[model samples]
Target chain A: MIEDKNQQRTNLSELGEFGLIKHLTKNFEINQPSTFKGIGDDAAVLDFKDKKAVISTDLLIEGVHFDLAYMPLKHLGYKSVVVNLSDIYAMNAKPTQITVSVAVSNRFPLEALEELFDGITLAAKEYTIDVIGGDTTSSQKGLIISITAIGEAEESELVYRNGAKSNDLLVVTGDIGSAYMGLQVLEREKQVFQVNPNNQPDLDAYTYIIERQLKPEARKDIRTLLHALEVKPTSMIDISDGLSSEIIHICKQSEVGCNLYEDKLPLDPQLINVCEEFNIDSTTVAINGGEDYELLFTISMDDYDKIKGNPNFTVIGHMTPESEGIHLVTRANTKIPLKARGWNALNG
Target chain B: MIEDKNQQRTNLSELGEFGLIKHLTKNFEINQPSTFKGIGDDAAVLDFKDKKAVISTDLLIEGVHFDLAYMPLKHLGYKSVVVNLSDIYAMNAKPTQITVSVAVSNRFPLEALEELFDGITLAAKEYTIDVIGGDTTSSQKGLIISITAIGEAEESELVYRNGAKSNDLLVVTGDIGSAYMGLQVLEREKQVFQVNPNNQPDLDAYTYIIERQLKPEARKDIRTLLHALEVKPTSMIDISDGLSSEIIHICKQSEVGCNLYEDKLPLDPQLINVCEEFNIDSTTVAINGGEDYELLFTISMDDYDKIKGNPNFTVIGHMTPESEGIHLVTRANTKIPLKARGWNALNG
Candidate 1:
């Protein structure tokens, strides 16, 4: 990815570990008032008076989670931060700080790492979060990234997956299956270009799906929107795994089953067209596709009046008693048991 | 490493991601009072009313940080947790929670992971910290572990490396250089085993140093001891990258010079014996050897009388004006400039 003819290609060893971290993080400025100290210390210090601190972590490996041939290092950096922040947002908390740890082999140039940090800096600035502390080390093979996101919220405002009860209405934000369709389009393009290196395939029509895959954003606005509408979710989770898998988690944890409707799944028109072109089922894509980064929650029926007709939300179904099983009601009125066909890294 | 002849070898795929995490973390219990929720949730939640939160992170890569040929999985897990907690303790804070994220290749069976978790659980129980949140995914090459430790302390009690002033006495807790000598013993034995597979390493004499290398304990008692003595340190850092490197860090950050005495460095008697047997310089081993996990701090001269005769504390150096520059005074009274020969992963 470091193809700049006019730029210098410096090796990482010249800077050393401390010098490299200082060089890359020099531009990051602390913006959060809760952050007492950021970087340049054994640890970062924060003060969240009277509020509970929420912490989440994620690990992303190169060949397993991504392919460098098509996935740019900058986008990978941005998405890594986005994925961790999605977990904090899923708790209905405001993300305040993040720590990023990256391990890279000697194959990567200093400029490549700079590009990756550029994307990370952009995400931190856009999200108004502080880059607190991190560790940089060498890897024997490919790149490995780990991010820990810290947030804060009042104890009473926090939501958990076990809070969902029977008769709660299931709701989801934004559209599904776009990211999966986007991956399909990218894979096809990759195969096409592999056979002929000189080929430049036209991909103007797959713009939406491709962006959904590479530049997915965490739902940072959902918590504010719900608060503004005076509606509180009984339980919530981010759709990192497919809709069916997350629904099953909420159901099993809360001791309640749910009836998910097939017709109510929100899908972008571009995704539907791509699914048809690829000869894939749209329903299957929506249920099993991962990395959407959307929010899925259950709200009590009393708050249904407040959320009804909201463009940001779609009421997919209602929860059932523990005696009933989780089922999907098809457009043809046929009932089928829901299955967790989400992506599994180990299984693959 | 998993050689259970009576038990069936279960592949990681059969449990999937969620099921694997649930099964592995089922035994983890929240023992810290600051922890409100642990595992299961999107993010772990904690409450630290008026105390400032301290957070630190570290990454350990196979072949770069540890060699699996000689390192056991259980010791690796415990050392990983201890390394992060050392950073927290270096800040003069009480570590209360941690999040561990691991990426492993398919070669690792479910039973192997259980052994790793067993070590992590032991650390959590011993340190009285809660195992909060984490992510587990498949890697392409080797195992990688990332841990983030969270702690709390009063704002006034926190110490940074930049706070040292002239005339402060540099004190270190416990002995150093044993771990490095222990590593030399292990590497030698490994080579012997490779040449003759029937050779058994008699490690009776190297027990103390070998334990120090594989199972080093963080200086968790130093803070309590300092509090009891009413001696607040001006600046502090953990000795993970050798004593010379850590001293250089404190001197550079605090804008002061230091005079470290060679004869004052605390070393175990067994370390001296091993150094003589290997024909290596004892002072060089003590200065450049790493992974000691001892606390090196600077305290005011007024507290010297209180800590002078204590066996747990050693005055190895004293801070001087910035114009003097950092130097080491040998036993022969010769002054030489100090150099940081700490291990650099990138260089390797």
Candidate 2:
């Protein structure tokens, strides 16, 4: 079925690296004051009043982490940076700098590289983060992008997975499953096109979903909003692997349990429509869909009033006693134990 | 000729990633005191009392940058790290930590990845550097490694390529051309193996030469040696892309020029022997061979006697006025201009 879309494949060389980076990261916003210089110079610079910093790096390779046949390098670059930034945000730190390392084959002309760089530079500009330094080299085939992101926060502001309390409230920003639906739609269209080259993809209806798959932004705004409200998350993490998987991480690490209501799951009408079209259970998708770069946190009951009515956030669940275990109450009034079907690359 | 060795090719799967990393960096040494951690952490933690930290990264891929059918992975990993570390060292700072990202295809079993990481971890331990964070991803094909090394030294102690002064003495650490000879020997053996797979490689005579190629270490000690003797290099760099190319960097950045005497060029007897056997000019190899991870620096005249008889160093020549240009004196007294024949991947 994938063959149906073979004709739709476009050569990446058409877009230069710089142009691609620019196209992809056009909407990003920088919310951290510590983000001194981002994206253009040889390296991004960050000045910190705090003493400690956390840095992490990741590499995504074509065919392995992605299929360029499906991925646009511009969007790929944006998603890649967002993925790493999620880790920094999860640690309650403000991201300030990033370094990108890319390896391409000679099969690709200079234009393809510039496209990749275009996305990088755009992300740098929008995130107000610097592209401090990176490695550029030749690959035997396909392409590899390695990114390192650095973040800083005061020692007091940093939140760890172990900080969740038994009675704290659990919340997630934005609606979930949209990004996952986006991927499903893209994959379906890809397969559809393979069978018939002239078949135009009915992409207009799936625009939002496809965009979610192609572009995911780090929730830098949540940090600022929470700070302005004078509330700090007892435990925080970005929904990367999936809500269930991340909830389990916090519960396991904090030795607490939680109870979430399926009906309370935030839903974007478009996400629901796509799930209906794809014959996927919306509840399941919302719970288990990964790559939703949204913030998930537990707040003290006293701070609830400050955030409860905010349109940008949803109170998806609340913490339960350890003995209650992490359970989900379905709309049919059935209580089921929560489980993880999160993306675990190593195990797979 | 490259195809002839195909029959004898050792599948990378045999070694695994961890095993390979161990094999390559088994002998590197850590000589700087400022290194807080060297290899084995989320991120290399650094403590520079009063310095502007400098970091640089470089990536190397198989088939494109290196012909692994002849180039060993151990050497590849070692050389890859050296190239990046050399950049940090070139800034006249002490390297303290490094992050390594690798992308490999499934054709390689897990063992091959272990081999690569083994060498990387060993290199970290030897250099007293901590292995911070890195990404391990699957690639479409071949192997790719991107390394980012972080280093720091006092602001006054830091040296840049642009700091070279007119009349400063040019100094080099260790001998050169051996690594190039090593490459020549390996290529020749690869050719021989292609003609006959069963014919064992007679490498007894090329032990030192091959070691130079497969296991070149960054000259971490040079910084300390100079400091201990109360001598600071006005400008410094590690010899990676060959002597001529490096001199050009110093000249262009420092806005100065110099004369290099061919007679004063340091070549070990083993290097001389191989040059004669291969019928390649030894001096040419020294100037253009590349992959010699030694330090080249400029020092003041008053410090000459301090390092004159040190076995680990060589006083090659002196820097002259800008108009003198970069000239290399021949053994027979002919003065000719030096050209940059160092590695340029764009052209390659």
Candidate 3:
């Protein structure tokens, strides 16, 4: 549906498997000292020395996780890397290497894969991580991308989801719900395009929301920022599955209930406007929308003074005893029980 | 086509994504010292300490890599992890942890996934590795599995493909070609079964070959054996893409040539019988067949005496200067150039 007309198409058979891998990764630069060896061997060798290694993996399937109609190949590749790296950042670690495995059907031309790799290379460079190793092969149907990100952190610096305690302050980085709104806008435009392919979408007002959806950057600078502020999170998790779900995860693992303040929930101005345009509730979107890629974490109440007015962070709420149950305090001073309305890929 | 007639089926959406992951990996035991924290977090934390880390990843898509008509879910899961771990063993590292990501269509019931994870758990127990993390999601088509294996070894003990030198003796552990023949037997059976569903063809004679194809094991004991013999390989690689392709890889990377002895190519007795029955060349299958999961490496001449006469290994060739091209020295006193007929996943 999104095929580019006038573009050069090269059959994947022209390069074969090994030839394609070599051609795609030939320009990948290895700048990480931790990477003792990169691609070209059976496995990539890494030297973490005294530091701890943090590993995370994610799988992205076409039609299930993304639609090619609105999601460009390059954007899809970039998002894949960023999402995996977000998990590392959630652990307060510095991502050092990534292994990307892609399985594409014959329907995708060589140029399409080149575009995907170009995005991967760009993200690796931008994140200052080495593209260590990967596998590329054919699929029977649509494209599939699996990325494993490796990061390094000192043993003492790492955070886990079970460290939060009752009364800890809940803090989130940046805004939420923008990516979900961006997806909504894109979906609407896709339907409009289906009706009239000649119609050009003038999406100037949706610039921020669309960028949030298409090119959402991980909170790479938050680790340094938190360190500079002398604040270590008691527990942390990335907001990939919406605020309500992540809050539930932290609560369940940390054995604490939370009072998430609806008034304090960070929502992008663009997201608010888009929700109004779509006649959706901004608070519901902020709490239940997914793919914000923001950092939702808990810090000791003692550190709240240090981050009181920081623009990068929003003091969302505070943890409570498990018996209190998880709730969102609305602006009307009424508390409502929160439910995990996150995107469930398996439900699709 | 291979579905059980009376197997219990449970929808996956009933458990949701988080509950399904929790259920599938609840039985995984963490026994590795390197694994500090496993699942229940955004990323797994590993303490590699002073050891170097080896990482490798592979993606297996249904139909492209295996046919479910003959491949069981459990065996498929086991083979997927084994294949990836084989890459780590090829680097002379002991695999410690792995992250598995799977995407399956709604057609796959919860019972099928349980069977698949059961095999993953079994392989982890057999290999003594930790199933640290993974992702489970739905696909639009068939099943897709991506696994990244992490191993560790001392810097001095690690091996790479570029360490081979001229005059080094090439050796291979165990036998080759049986796995390819096993696949042939299974394919033929599948075809026959299609013609008559109730036909029960005897497969006793093809037991070993079928087992090799369906439930192959990686050479995890080779490293210990080589260490006990006090012989460090100059260069090493796993035979995942047939003998000739791996030889070419080592030769090209190490800047050396090889003279492989056709008569010395290791072949199982069952493979010979099967080749005779199928009217195929045993030598060709030995050199060109894939998925043997055996170790192919070169050791310096000084270590040859230490490894010679070992029943687990066979000296198949010797490295030569780059000026001499790679060739096969036949027992009939004829030198024929070697060609790589490795399975190309992208070709299909």
Q: Interface RMSD in Å per candidate, to 1 decimal?
A: 0.6, 3.6, 0.5
| Chain A only TM-scores, each candidate in turn | 0.96, 0.85, 0.97
CA shift of A87, model 1, Å: 0.7
lDDT of 3 by residue, A1-348 (tens): 343552789999999799999999987999999999999999999999999999999999999898989888888889999999999999999999999999999989899999899899999989999999999999988999999999999999999898999999999999999999999999999999999998889999999999999999999999999999999999999999899999999999999999999899888888888989998888888888899999999999999999999999999999999999999999999998888973442123
Query: What DockQ, on C-alphas, does every prediction get?
Result: 0.89, 0.35, 0.92
Q: What's the candidate order when arranged by decreasing TM-score? A: 3, 1, 2
Tens digits of per-residue lDDT for model 1, A1-348? 212332768999999888899999998999999999999889999999999999999998998887777777788888889999999999999999999999999988898899889889988987899999999999999889999999999998898898889999999999998988888888887887778767777878988988888889999999999999998899999998889989998998899999999999999999999989988889888888989999999999999999999999999989999779899899999988888873442136
Best by lDDT: 3
Find the 10 residues in a row with the least total lDDT in model 3 chain B: B339-348
> Each model's C-alpha lDDT?
0.90, 0.72, 0.92
In candidate 3, position A101 carries an lDDT of 95
Candidate 3 CAPRI grade: high
- Output the better candidate (1/2) by lDDT: 1
lDDT tens digits, residues A1-348, model 2? 222122233444454444444443444444455444333322233345433466767778777667666677667777888888887887777777777777777666555555666677677776777666665655667788888877766667777776889879899998898988888887777777778767866678877777777888888888888889898999887787688988887887788999888999998899998889888788888888888888888998888899979987788888877888998888997888887763332225
lDDT of 3 at A218: 99
Estimate the lDDT of model 1. 0.90
- Error of model 1, residue A175, in angstroms: 0.4
State which candidate has the highest DockQ: 3
